[model samples]
Target: MEVMEIIKDAFVFPSKDMKTLLIYVLLSLVAAGFSFFGTVVYVLGFVNPECFMWGGMAVIISLLIGWVMYGYLISVIKSGIEQSDEVPGFEWWENFITGFNNFIVTIVYFVIPAFITVIVGYMTNVYGNAMIVAQEIYLQATYSYMGSSSAIAFDAIYQALVNLLFSLTITITVAVVVFVIFSFLQTMAEARLANTGSLSEALNVFEAAKDIRRIGIGKVIILVLLVIIIVAVIEMIFSALFSIIPILSILSIIIAPYLAFFAQRAVGLLYSDIA
Candidate 1:
């Protein structure tokens, strides 16, 4: 199918296959569990230096869990697609098959894309830093003549501006790199699913991948906005509760990370449908 037509068809389905989608989400959660645990452990180490060892353990555990979860997720999606006429299929070994496919795909899809992205990101950062430094030099030179009284103020202002510019540049640079990488992966995933294995076949999928992002970004944009809004509101409400109730405050602290993880995984599943 043509790119637009594939999108139209995908949207027509509109994730009516909830069972399959839910299975995918569950698998994602399973994979995410370890990462979350590791993060929490690492954070806690700030309060207790000795906990660093525990954090290290958490990191190792998380990787193992994430790998297993990813494997299962791949199997579920593959099986569900292959047997679309029936109800969704869920299996444990699908993870292994997915892992194998990923092993091949890593070399095929990820390594080169990642390398190019890193190179592009490095160049962008260098350009951005150069601009910041030049702007700082211009400001410092302009201010040095303005008497010593304002020199300190100008120096502070210059520093702040340079920092902000550097931060903004890094953020935009990273975002573009990520978007490009995601676009590459989206096309590759669809191509893999569609069984377009040859290099020529895969390159053709890039056309569809770009189209998918162009057409489908809007579909899930609202979901992202909603999640951000809701999370902010939830955190605010919880913050208020901490002032009024001590016990629930602690619970909220513990629960917030999981809530964030859940929100991210939920959003991830929606995007995976198109990918």
Candidate 2:
């Protein structure tokens, strides 16, 4: 299938089974809503330490919902890839297991990148904090020699900022590359798992990488970029329209699943063609 055809089908395919799609939407809404709530709780906790307990509970519940939803969506995408006639609906135990497995795949795939990011972040924090303390001490010690030490203080601050920015840039760059690579692998793996019902196959990095090459890495990258652009545009439009009416923003919970499914279906269709 051509990329355009895949994209077109993504938008049109769900209508063929609107009832099932709606059911998926409802489930998606619950998952997304809770996830959003959890994030809000976390932010609140960050702003006010007293909310930490509530935030922790919310985050845990949200993670559970998000995982189940992720698995269910993969099931939906798999159905699309196989050109199955029936749309998938809620299968609680099945979805949870699949979701958990998918989560594991993601964590395992990104562990190295995540570890690097954490280490870099921690180092940046420590270095930045040390710089602040040193600057303070420098100012205290040089109170009588302020004129001579001003340059030293300025240089110290500039170096600290430069180091922080450089570390952040490297961290972000590495993260983005890792994310794109794993995203390609995961898409193929999920589609395969969905098609073959084998967790082992889904987790097979070598096989997934081979499929990515077969599918044409360039094409996959292009398709992913296109999907991201389309989704971003849709989100911007949705946000603009919905922001005017606070209550209407709730509709995104329902709409987001459809958009997500559409993207997944697009990739699934593309995978089906290449496979």
TM-scores, all candidates, are 0.44, 0.75
Per-residue lDDT value at 226 in model 2: 91
Residue ranges of candidate 2 with Cα displaced over 4 Å:
29-65, 118-148, 244-250
Output the worst ten-in-a-row residue range by lDDT, candidate 1. 5-14
lDDT of 2 by residue, 79-173 (tens): 76776646677787888888888887777667756776677667657466556757766674676376555666666666766666776776677
Residue pairs in collision within model 2: none
User: Tens digits of per-residue lDDT for model 1 on 160-275?
Assistant: 56766766576567667766656446433533433332334434446546544754655545444555666688788988888888778755533453343334333334434544
- Measured over all alpha carbons after superposition, the RMSD of each candidate to the real structure, in angstroms, is 8.9, 4.7
lDDT (Cα, 0-100) at 200 in candidate 1? 44
Off by over 4 Å in 1: 1-33, 46-50, 76-83, 100-114, 117-135, 138-186, 189-275
